[model samples]
Target: MPNSPSAKKALRKSQKRRLVNRSNRSALRTNLKKARVAVEGQPSEAADDVKTAMRHLDISAGRGLIHKNKAARLKSRLAKKLNAALTES
Candidate 1:
């Protein structure tokens, strides 16, 4: 338990931040999943999803919700999948 008033306030702020981060993280994961599914389904459809997902990833990374390197890696993998799908079709 927080003993000081400042500590109590800090705890409250932390809880709020945690909730916000959780919501944002959930959104990010959902966007990533949508992108992956679209990439697996059709290259044309995947383009928009990938772009949206990448945008979300960038925002999340910038906000410290996710690691920048992981975001870059995911974007790379998505692009690779998109390229492969385009070539295959």
Candidate 2:
């Protein structure tokens, strides 16, 4: 339905960007899951897992795969979990 060449190219670029963003989001979810599980099971590694999750979140936010506020909220939650783990230990 793109009448102009620029419109066609834009559509193609958007599609490609969407696919890449989806993959990045999936990866971010995976990393977050890993961090949560690590914190739940092995409290000692929670800090490191949290750091890794934060890095992934920052990357996703930078790429526009997720909102910056959402990313910050996730990071905050992870840090809270880490703190709880520390307190429990």
Best by TM-score: 1
TM-scores of all models? 0.97, 0.93
Clashing residue pairs in candidate 1 are: none
Backbone clash total for model 2 is 0
lDDT string for model 2 (1-89, tens) is 89999999999999999898888888889999999999999989677878999999998889878899999999999999988988999
Top model number, lDDT: 1
Candidate 1, lDDT over the whole model: 0.93
Minimal lDDT window, size 10, model 1? 38-47
- The per-residue C-alpha lDDT of model 2 at residue 73 equals 95
Per-residue lDDT of model 1, residues 11-33, tens digit only: 99999999999999999999999
lDDT of 1 at 2: 100
Q: Give candidate 1's error at residue 57 in angstroms.
A: 0.5
TM-score for candidate 1, residues paired by index: 0.97
